[model samples]
Structures are given as C-alpha cells and as structure tokens.
Target chain A: MSTPSTSSAPAEAGPRDKHALAAAIARDVPDGAYVNLGIGQPTLVAEHLREGSGVVLHTENGMLNFGPVATGDDVDLDLTNAGKIPVTELPGAAYFHHADSFAMMRGGHLDVCVLGAFQVSANGDLANWHTGAPDAIPAVGGAMDLAIGAEQVWVMMTLFAKDGTAKIVPTCTYPLTGLACVDRVYTDLGTFELAASRGRADGAVVVRDLSGISLEELGGRLDVPVVLG
Target chain B: MSAASILASYADAVADVEDGATVLVGGFGMAGMPVELIDALIEQGAKDLVIVSNNAGNGDTGLAALLAAKRVRKVVCSFPRQSDSWVFDGLYRAGQIELEVVPQGNLAERMRAAGAGIGAFFCPTGVGTPLTEGKETRVIDGRTYALEYPIKGDVALIKAHRADTMGNLVYRKTARNFGPVMATAARTVIAQVSEVVPLGGLDPEVVVTPSIYVDRVVCPTAQES
Candidate 1:
C-alpha cells in the first residue's frame, strides 16, 4: 500500500488547505442554482461563491438567501444555519415554517447540495452521519435528505483520514446516508468526477489536481484506482 | 370573541402533561424553544416523556435541562448530538435514554402530515439507507421511496413572537422552526409567546398559525430561566 509523502515542506503551496478546496468547489456551482450547504466544510462554500453569483443559499432551519457568518451585533441567536452558527440574512431573504423549508429540500426543489462525508464508495454511496463507533454519538441531520433529494449531490472532504485511511474506497464500511447519490468528490488533493460505468459500480477520474501532486502520486494514496483525464 | 386561552402561570400551562406522554417541543436548536414551558415540565417532574424537536438543545438549557433533570425517556429528533449536548451523550452512552434520529426534512414532513390528516406518505429521503430498513418501500414512476408515517403528539410546546388574545401567532424569523407545524399536530397546543395582543392586532396575512389550533397561551418572564 502506498503511503502519503512525509516531506516536511513542499516547494510550492499545494491544494492542501481547506479554503483553497472550498474555492475550487465554489467555482463550479452554476449561477441561479438553489444550493444547500451542509454543515462543516460544505458551509465554507457559501463564503467562496462569487458575491454577485445568483446562487441562492438555503438553510433547512427556514431561511433562503442567508448571508455569511455574523459578527458582533449582527449575530442573531435565532438566525443560524444547520450547524447552529449565527448567520446574517441577505437582502430579499425570506423565512418560512420549518416544514415548508424542508419541502424545498425533500421535494427535490434544490438544485445542488454540498455535503461532508466520512466515506464515499466508488458507486457513489455516501456515509457521513455515523461511524458506528460504540461510544460515538450519531446524529443524522438533514444530510440524508439532501444526499438523495437534490438534483446533484457534491461532497467536500479531505482525501484521507487522520489515520491515513482513504475515504474514497471501493466500498463503504460505514453506515450509508444514501446510495448512488454523490456525483462528484472535491478534496484538498483535487477534484474527481464519478461516472457510472459497466463492470464498475462507479469509476472516478481525476479532473483537476494541485501542481505539486501528480496523478500517479494521488492514485497511490488511495486503495481504489483513480484515472487521470 | 370567545374567552381568552391565556393561562395564569407556567405551572398551570403544562399541568396537563402526564408521564410517558409524547410531546412536540418546538425549536431549531435553542432558537425558538419554549424555555419557560420546558422549565415548567422539569418542575412538573413528568417522567418517561418522549420529546420531539429539531435538536436536543445546545447546552444546559432548554431541552437539555429537562434531560439533565432526568425527565426525558426518549428523544425523537433530527439532530440530537450537538457539540454542547453532553447531557444527552452521557445518558445515551449509559443506555439510560433512547434516541430515534430522523432526517430534518422527514421529521418536519411527518409532523406536518399528522396535522394535515395524511395517513402516510412516500418520501425519497432515506431511500436506501439504514433508515429504510424494515420499513415499507414502493416504486413510483421508476423512483424508489420509503413510506413514512405521520407524527402526532399528546401536547405541543411552542414558542412564538406574539399571539393575539384569540391565539393567532406570529413567529420571529428563523426562530419559527417547527412551531407552526407542531401547533396543528398536537391534541393540545400550548404556546409561550413574548407578547399577547388584542384580537385583530395581528394582520391576517402575517399570521402564520390561526387561532383554531392553539388551546392555551402563556407569556413567561423575559429570561430563559
């Protein structure tokens, strides 16, 4: 099994930081898309979307066109995202009852939803809610709804776990949140497009990568083979 | 107009709740939770209670206080394990408290379905996950959906910004989460509002919940207590 390089430093700054990866994902979100940014790294996508981009942000708590994180007096304890962090409401923001807001989610009205993941199988199965650890407290928020409800499901996460385990595996060992739902996986290493193929549940191809990392190096870090396209 | 539904005190407002009753406590995290009502329930000391909400609570406040007080036997919610939900974490790990995690959308729809008198609905959410295990499934127009049942409560504890003497309610921004739907799904709806105005003080267009659903109203002290 190939291991992540242990070099202390690289000559150039690679796409290893969260903000850079977030920006990379933000660039692909089309204008006029009604998007739901899931908790954790997916929430960072809101800060990266172009200011004038017509991407309307939806929070399951019942707000549309919700703004960036709030600071100082702007913080309204009641105005928050799924992560329960205070957020400002943008101009033309509308609030509705929680059930109505979720109708927009589960009714397949959302265009795109970006979520974080613990494991993503080659066939696009997603597992992020629980690790099934005996002591772990599992909470399945709106992730299950967004994973299967949106027109497109995009996942934002690191390529590997802290223990050097590949998150994009041939099959998920963790409990699944949805099956055959993830369309693309964006990681600090690069972006991979998952496609349905014969004889394979799903085939992943690296569409973009950092300058410092080659396709061969990226492929070596995962248990499953990823092609460079 | 009919007699005011206003209750004299918090204790009187929640006096009807009994042990093992399923209650829908409205809120999204700590935002719109009926803190005063929860405190009353804690004081009432009803045991084996089933709580339905978006979250357990942020910290040692709201539903967390009730759980910390050992008044809750089970929690049916979408997000129960928040960062500050140590009280629930302790009880859950010790096998003292039971949890039924639902997707946020599904949770809301189930409550709404109950209020609307819908028997059951097929939803695309949780189609192939463990949430669908042992549940009925159907294929409509070549798309698979899991059958979900309506969720009704014995009582609903709701928080609103204001209510008319007649019990029509208006919510404040995102704090309105779950209040309107829970109001209709419960046998008795008890609303804790910050202000109560005369009938007609609220515009019909702005009223989120009509008076027909509310059974009682109370204005607790300004503090969360």
Candidate 2:
C-alpha cells in the first residue's frame, strides 16, 4: 500500500537523556577536521567542542571558519549562521560558491558528520527522516546529504523515545536515507557498534560498555530486545 | 491532479520572482541550494530583498551574490560565520542588515512547526538567557523554557536532485538540506531540479517533499557554473 504505517504507540526503550548522549558523541570528533553539523541535538556538538582543536565547521549555508559560541562583545548581530544567530567567525575562513560547498560534500571531503536518527537497524540502515506517520511533518532536509556526504556518519540520539521504545531497531520499517551508512551509535545506555558482516544478512549490534547501569533496568525503558553480551 | 507546469525555460522561472521580496533559500552551508535559480535571481537584479538562509556563501557566489548587489536588507539565520568577509562584520556594526539569530536546532524546529501549522511551542534552549528577553517564557518541571515563534517565509527557494512532473522531489544526499522544509514553510515555494521525471516513475516512499506544496520549478543546464 502507498500509505506508510507504523504502530501508533512508541516502542518501549530505556530511559535516557539526549543531551548526555550528544555530549558523548561530541568527544569522538577529533581536532582540525572538517565537519558538517546536522540539525537537532547534533548542532549542540559545536558548543561542547574543546577549544584550540582547530576544528573547521561547515554549515550547509556556506561557512568554513567559525569559532566557539559568541560571548560578550564578540556577538555581532549580523554575522550569524544559516540559522541566523550571532556567531563568532574565526580568522582565515572564506565563503565560496555554494555549489562548490555541495561539491565538497558529494565529493566526500567532510571528515565527520553527526546526525540525528529515528531508527538505526542492526545492519546499519539509517532512517532519520519521514516516520511514515500521517501526522508527522513531511520533509527531510540536509539529513540525506549529511548521511551520505560525510565520510563517517555518527548518530546521536536517545536509546528510546518518550514512550520507552528503542530507536535502535533490528530493521527500519520506514524509508531509509542510506544503507549501511552508520558508523557508530551513541545513546544514554552506552555505546553500540554494528558488527560488520559480508552482506545484508544483518549484523549484530553489540553494546561495547554500560555506564554503571544494569541491562534489565535499561531494557525496561525500551520496546526492543536488548541482549547483554 | 492538475497538470503541473514544467519550467520550460530559465527566463520564465526568473520572471515569477520580484525584487526586494523576503526570500528564504533552502540548504545549509552550501549543499542542496539551487545555483541556477540563484544566478537567475542575481541576473534579474532582485535587490534589497530580505534574505533568509542558513548562512551566506563564501564570497561572490550563491547568496553572496545578493549580498554583493546590496539587495539583502536583513538575514535571519541560526548562525552567521565571520570568516567569509569583513563586510558582514561591518554590516552588523553599521546595522545595515538586521540579523535575527536563533539557536540552530530551535530554528529548524520553529521552521518545522511553521510548516506543520503549529503556532508556537516552548523549549528550554534559550531560557534564562538574553535570547529569552522580550519573548514569552513558561516554567515546567522546575525548569523554564522560552516560547519560540514559528518561522514562515514569503518565498522559499530550494533545489532538489530529482523532481517528478507532479512535484514530488527526491534529494540526493546533503542537497536535501532544508529544501523540503523550506518548500512547505514558505508562502510560495520555488524549486530548481537537475532532472524532471514522470509522475509514477518516482517511488512514493522515496519522495521527500510532495508536489502539493510546490508552485514553480526551474531546470538548470548541466553546464557547470
């Protein structure tokens, strides 16, 4: 059927705060690298980044040299980002043809891209946009670009939704933006890496470590099965 | 469905837009933007317009063309990077271009809400800060949130990878950046597509933005700009 369908109720996953997970993923982004910050919690990655890392931030709006958040007198009302807020511009940054900017993305020049995810399958299918809900907003923005354009796609999201369902599923029933595109997943419970395999047989998503939280307690907050390895 | 008019020529596409109008161009830094439409807008001398985009391009290209023409009166985006040129810094110092800056995430949510017909919503992003000043505030769960207004546009300019005659768009990678959302949030949505396909040819599930929200289409020649 043309109509996309999913359960009205959110899947039950463990309780987790997204901000903490976002912070964890931010730690992974190295210094002096070209990065595209996706919308949603991923944008906060810039705020949490360490100073003097020489990280060059690229927004789809056309920017390269941006410093840490604006503070005190540095806040220029006119020098803002695609989001159109006052931001600090670093020295030696240049704006060029936006087509060249996309060329950078499609050309696979970005080092890392942090994106928000709705569902990440065990086999590494990334589906961030379009939940198939009729009531949900019907649009997918730069996510498609960030997913495939960046060399590494790191998804920052909570382990579960408000209804306690695991966003990290075995298979994504919704439309996918990229196949086997995810590199790692950072959730409140801990971090998980999709065990790579030869083909689409669906690899196992193994949680590397837990932060002093029990699996049973964490599983209580999710709708999907959480196997403790 | 009424037969959607195909953009047979670039001149026809440029004619629909006027000078000095509030124009919201889709894309983030530079991905997913319609370079051809931007060129046409520049060629048409549509100056002094309120330009809303994620960020201005590096220099003398993309949205910078409008900025160069001195056609842009104001820019409303989440963040404006300073490395592009000293002119923007001077403009801010001189207050020539008023920049209404919102947090990047909040800006996207506000745009999404505007497109979804939501009047307003509360979020803790800007509460208890200068960003909250002069805006509504509410306390929930012992925490305060700033009441953010929705974002809408008079004209939303977007670029898609492929578009069916029905206007259903399929964006390729980063090019999908704010294109779909900008398409719906604007009073009039204009798109520039690399390829125009038949209606049924595009899979329904793959279509990101439905044709119902689209009003005009501009096809760019393959010649590199």
lDDT of 2 by residue, B1-225 (tens): 453456856656667676668788876655665667777788777767777776655455777666766778888765454356444555666667777655444556677778889999876544433345788888788655678788888788888877787778877544566677777788778788888876688999878788888877666542211
Give candidate 1 regions above 4 Å deviation.
A1-13, A195-206, B1-4, B220-225
| Maximum-lDDT candidate | 1
Off by over 4 Å in 2: A1-229, B1-3, B85-87, B221-225
Give candidate 1's TM-score: 0.93
Pick by DockQ: which candidate is best? 1
Can you write out model 2's per-residue Cα lDDT over A139-190, one digit (the tens) per residue? 3444554565678878878776778677888678776756667877777667
Task: State the lDDT at B75 in candidate 1.
Answer: 93
Residue B86, candidate 2: Cα error in Å is 4.7
Per-candidate count of clashing residue pairs (backbone under 3 Å): 0, 46
In candidate 1, list every pair of residues with a backbone clash.
Answer: none
| TM-score per candidate | 0.93, 0.51
DockQ values, each candidate: 0.80, 0.03
